[model samples]
Target: MILIRARVEAVLEPGRRTEVRVPVLLIASDRRWLELLPSQRARLKGRFGTPRSADLLAAVVVVRGPPSVLGPPSPLQRAAETVRARLRRSVDRLPADQRGVLPGMVVGDTSRIDPDLAEVFRTAGLTHLLVVSGANLAIVIGAVLGLCRFAGLGRRRAPPVAVLAVLAFVVVARPEPSVLRATVMGLIGLLALFTGRRRQGLPALAAAVLLLVLIDPTLARSYGFALSVLATGGLLVLAPPWRERLRRRLPGPLADALAVAAAAQVAVAPVLVMLSGEVGVVSVAANLLAAPAVAPATLLGALGAVTALVSLTLARLVVWPAGLAVAWVVWIARTAARLPYATIPWKGGGLGAVALLAAAVVAVLILRSRRLRLVAVAAMAGVLIAVVGLRLLAPGWPPPGWALVACDVGQGDALALAAGPGRAVVVDTGPDPRLVEGCLERLAIRDVPLLVLTHPHADHVDGVAGVRSHRAVHAVLTTPRGPGREARFTSGLVVRQALTGQRWSVGDLTLSVLGPLSAGPRLAPGDDGTTVNDASVVLVARRPGFSALLAGDVEADAQRALAGSVPAVQVIKVPHHGSRSQDPAFLAAAHASVALISVGRDNDYGHPAPSTVDRLRSLGSRVHRTDQEGDVAVVRTTGGLSVVPRR
Candidate 1:
């Protein structure tokens, strides 16, 4: 059995549907982990949004009920929490996305950060901007000193003041492991500067690393630590030279961004691949896009955090510029993350890291060669020309003749059934409209003849706008709207109930509703809280050479009923995100050639449960889960069936 002992951090914090993703802190004996979830989180009850300024001693544990606090948090801790809380409330009236990003830009109160928003940052390689780290600290403290210098403060006076500012900001940020690491690194650089050892950048970095490792040996094994130290070292040793070279041709602002992005990317790309198994194609470009917003957002957010203690209204007034800055960053992340080939999958682990490091070093060396630089520039320009030419002319995506595409929309379902050129039948928009919109855009789908919602779960139907955004949605099909779920994709388009035996055609593909039989089993009167997932509308699709059993969220009881009406198929969208609510006999009956499960990565609830995947595999179906493989597609050719993954 897998066991997780977590400490409650905050409660009823903003959620995605109503707002943003709330966070709870998991306090293990060894370390703390932030738990981001929709499951288990809802089970806790209380007036639980504790002000960040309070002594945060209370907790609701899932494994063991409320553990005793060893003692109250220290006064400094209380003060920091208060500032963070005030900062949070000051921006509470803003759009949830903007609000979620504000505290994060300042002190990293990411409890309000939506998982969908976080995922966008991850894909765009902008995770650092959202997380509390050295970069944020450096920007805030540096700006403070720069302001003082501009006001004619002497150099000696500015350094000491900046040092104090760093310490104070670190406390306000709560000195989590990553924050602590950043503080230590910043101090080392500052110490070097003060001692007139600025040329010893590498030595300063080495000393910081040695001292940190001695203090917390576990950090030696930390991916964050490796990334942090390497990134700082890159900035100190590599960025300045690149800046000088690029300044020869590029504007100062462009040159600085290019140098900073390249240095960090080269230094951390290997570790990033080691941890995430992919290198973002848009990392440099995304960083450039978001660069203009970071400093303003950070400074204004910090100002708002401090001012909220005095006047909430003033704090609100102060944060609007910060919120706008955050909005720009969010927009950059979303747009860059969805670009075709956002990341490049690479070999993971130590060997891959070492190989990539060597390659990065070689590229740096080539950049130093004047003659080779011209050739490299020409080669890069040629690649860009080819890419843009193809994008404008032949467009290489949605790979011709593809039959089915299962979008990687986190813990939800969004799929497309090809109809004709630029047309498809879309099913089940995921939780975030933006995510599903990108999926459709990637497929080049411009018209949706029929859009089917499996059920009324927020994860299933919430992304209606994505379906309606780019296309003329002729009609919509779904079960009778669940409580409070009457809103749909198009007011003009009809939402027909998906009763059993309902049949339709989109291009050559035939769709038949196979489940939610009329007059079927629902709950007894007193069991009103039971979910209606078992009542989800199941569909079966078939064409000349391809067939699929698309079971929505039906559980064992209804799975048995649906099995009786099933058609033999080559693929199946496993029901209920492959929860263990499956009936083995039902899976055996369908015997689909491929079983597809759509789920979010690192979800709280163990989805596409291991046993469920084993059950499908045991029944002779090759299993594919979206959480692991990403945007799975089934293509049928003359030979047999094949599976293609986005990344």
Candidate 2:
């Protein structure tokens, strides 16, 4: 699919006749539309729809067959697109991750970035590196100013060169609100530098903000714009004082780096929390660790893009060092993201912002006192040591002797039945990739002997990339019916039809597919997919004294069909997330010691229906809902089976 920004030249209606310049998102399947450039007009045949709350566009246009070119793009846009294409080609031979990252770091072209790596970048809080920001422009302007100095140009003459560099960088990055904000901030810095007055920085910043906001009032609502302004303000208003304090005890370079990272993180923390609903505990460290390579990568990438215009060979030569730099940055992001507790969940929205600001105030006030500062440091150090000690010596996650784990993936099913150390049978990889990936990582699951996708529903298979990102899956099994486009990520994998009476063994565990006695029926793609839910692959896993029936989202009809085959077990994954359409006799036949229900909190669909919970309870089974607990695990104990809830 191609997403294009276009204006409404005319609205198609019974008698309407007008032209409007409103922004719209055009979704089209024709590959030819991908060639369209910014500022070019297009005659689109589509149905106009209202934009969703989260969409940035004013309207959504679903285009038919193809687009008709209305006009050619301006010369500047054409040149920029050509330069971007060349920059992309410059890193054609680099490592896969580096090739994707270099262009993104240089010109904000992220089309080539792997989805898994993009998620890793988000988790590591290194997402900023992929986008064009004040940092990128600052590096470019700094390099240009240094070059001017080396060329014997005085400071007075350097500002003009820096201005040219900023404008050029803006064009390459696309003149979006965020890029424009960065450009203005870069010019403000150059203004301060050319005038030889450090104090003018704040006034220049204020003037720049005032002018930019006046020019585009919508920027005030842009998150990227806010982050860019906050980061630049942090560098100017907070970094100098913090650096002076750090220099007293550390080397100049280390102090400067630490100060800049901490200041930016501090300034953006509240907004970041509001945006992501999580606070990056490791972002400052990750940024500082990756900072050294960013400049070389940015500068080299820019050089490569420029040189590509002359010779592709020269561009490749310049980008070779850039690959190494990008590799280092990617490594840092992956390593940092792999750390447990890399980010801590925080509230989102207005309350979260106020809470963060209040906490910052308290921290600052305490740091102002020498005695209080020492006490605070000691307290933080003690807490950190205690948490680390617990994680290493007695990590509560993935409890030992675990037979099965139901990952809390918010209204979806992602379960792991242990096969051996760092190996398991993963089933129904939840709705969100990151959520499921985090669950697998916490379990230290490195190998999957078998992956069972119950059905093609998005909640069950949208997270395929996360599961396969850094692990080895020997094989995959799914229902007889093919999955839809939502499960396209797994299309490359060879998937076998999971038939009734099929069996597989890995390590000490045995798995048997036990349901959908027939090939089942097919429904239109636009249907509610309840028939597909009934066609879910049902399996029962057994290991030593532990056994559990892994029921997919089968409703009552499928449950009744499998009633004769259902066997009594210690645990049962409540079908359809315990929707009201459950078969009581089928549930009662399980005779389980534990009933694990996976569902989301405050979900639109009232899952884990109270009736289902009561029915399971009436059967003398212990019920555990993932919405209440973070991850629910069933562990074998000497006495009997015990449930461990990770909250």
Candidate 3:
């Protein structure tokens, strides 16, 4: 029954397009097991359905509890809801820094996790503490065992008590995928302990993984699932040998902690690098300091939270201890985050990650002997130093020379023009700060003489923070017009708008706004109590023989209005990410040598419509999209134009 329950819980349903009407069969069996069979897997589509289209035709079967309960808010749902509510309340009382750690520690609720903090945790190499995995369970079991021994509990009775404790912990944590995965791993660890077979850990971990994947084939695509499995496997396979080696040089306890941290990091680093495109050089050092605090903090926090729920007065007494633990974690995160270059950005994808992992494996194999280990370590350090040295001594940006870059910012538009040397003029700040920052970093853009915001849309203005953070802006230019169709600068960058419309020189480039003409109508603040796309600020930049126009999110009406008034442009940043709202006359009049589109991948709005691309192509304009080429750059040359892609 337990095995069947585990299989059923692990199963992922096939995808369904809609809530199709299908017959469901319920089979009742002894030992209180109920099986649900869907008549047609094709008819069961929804958020809970499988993620793959091919899987939709597969059988949809679920086995849980008894036949009496087979509907919405299944047993798992009911339990998760109760746990989530309690977690929400507990987190609400914690400081912002500590709030995110709770869900991760208790049940792996990453929904509220902060990206920056998560990065720090990863860099500091303490990410395992955030997940309720085998390590967490081991800590709990070990503590319980120690307590039992102190209380004079019999060894035989202790196992039963530990099992019961495990069950209670699972219930409180809720049966999420991570919790279930951890529980299975924990149970196996306990079984190994009881049988006095330490070597059983690897086999148990592998078996658990196979069982999980077999039950839910969809987990193959889940990064979290892969990371959890790999981290656990790494610990099981590498920690022992690593610990043994470390014990020879350091105190037993310190060596054990360092080995555990190193093993998990070695196992998960490839995946983390692939997903994040950055490596934490300081992760090992950070985790060394943080390791001792995680267990006590989590245990105390959990106990205090549970006690507070039961008795407010008693909860207050425990809060101090809990607070101290939380403070330690908070301190670790802040300190790690403050370190310069804590995370070194790297190029990532499947190939890079695989190569890195292969390298790690080779390095590990080479470490078997003391002499080779020292040599391997020295070689690795040398390689790192060489890479850093080359990067620092490199003549100019990887792909040197001037270029105009169109940043991928989803539905908004942002283009950067490098006049010559390190001088540049920026037009539009993309909708997301992080995305824009990534684009700038790729281009090695440092200083901006003019920061032109095409008009304020959250998409265009949100990336202003990124600009302010990375580059020195002498002046900003915007169409005298305020936010066109939506609330402007809500993401905390609006305060920097004071320099709008002020012209600034950056070495040799000049930037200025062309429209949002003071005489134009107040852009018909739409029925939604805001202006529409027609009011976007349009920018025109000129430098020697090079010229470009940055059309914000302006629609056809504004495009037509501007076409009759503005001067010819050599390059055009297609308005509204090549939305169909563009005026044909405007495209023809601009006669741009190049057209740039800033759009995100798989965006729902279907930007850069076929017709718009065709129109620009028909006019002898070369069109480039950020989605395909990453940051697109156009540099002015005495003879003509030079193009570069961040990719």
lDDT of each: 0.76, 0.85, 0.64
Off-target runs (Cα >4 Å) in candidate 3 are 1-94, 110-114, 144-168, 171-177, 191-199, 345-347, 361-647
lDDT of 3 by residue, 1-647 (tens): 11121112222345633334332222112234323322111121111222122221232233222444345445655554555555556556667666667657755555566645665575566776776766567767777888888999876667667877788777666554555667777777667666666647677777777777787665665577778888778788899998998999999999998998788878888888776666677787777787787787667656655665666556545544555676687678779876756776665667768878787778768866798888878987998899789758754433555556777665567777875555566777776677677667767778866677766555677677777675777666555555442234333323233232544455566655555555665443321112335556676667776777777777787777778766677888888778777889988988887888887643434577879999999999998877656567676667877666544
lDDT of each residue in 325-441, candidate 2, tens digit only: 999999999999889888877777679999999988998899789998999999999999998897788746778999899998877899999988899899989977878998999
* Candidates, ranked, lDDT: 2, 1, 3
lDDT, candidate 2, equals 0.85
TM-score, each model? 0.64, 0.69, 0.59
Give the Å error, residue 581, model 2: 18
Question: On a 0 to 1 TM-score scale, where does candidate 3 land against the true structure?
Answer: 0.59
- Name the Cα RMSD for model 3: 11.6
Candidate 3 collision pairs: 13-50, 14-50, 16-45, 403-634, 403-635, 404-633, 404-634, 431-459, 485-531
Give one digit per residue, the lDDT tens place, for model 1 in 1-647. 01243344343446632333333333221112222211223233222322221122232232222333334556676777778888889999999999998888788778788766887899998998877888788787688778888989876667677788889998787656667777776777766566666546667668778888898665776677788888888888889999998999999999999999888877789888875668788988999889988989998899888899999999999999899999999999999988977987776668878878787787878878999888989998999899788768852455557889999898889989888889989889987787898889888899998898877666788888877885788888886423224254446777677777878998798999887877765533222211467767789988878888888788888887777677678899999888878987778777798999998765545576779988888888998877757788787778878887876
Q: What's the C-alpha lDDT at position 619 in model 2?
A: 95
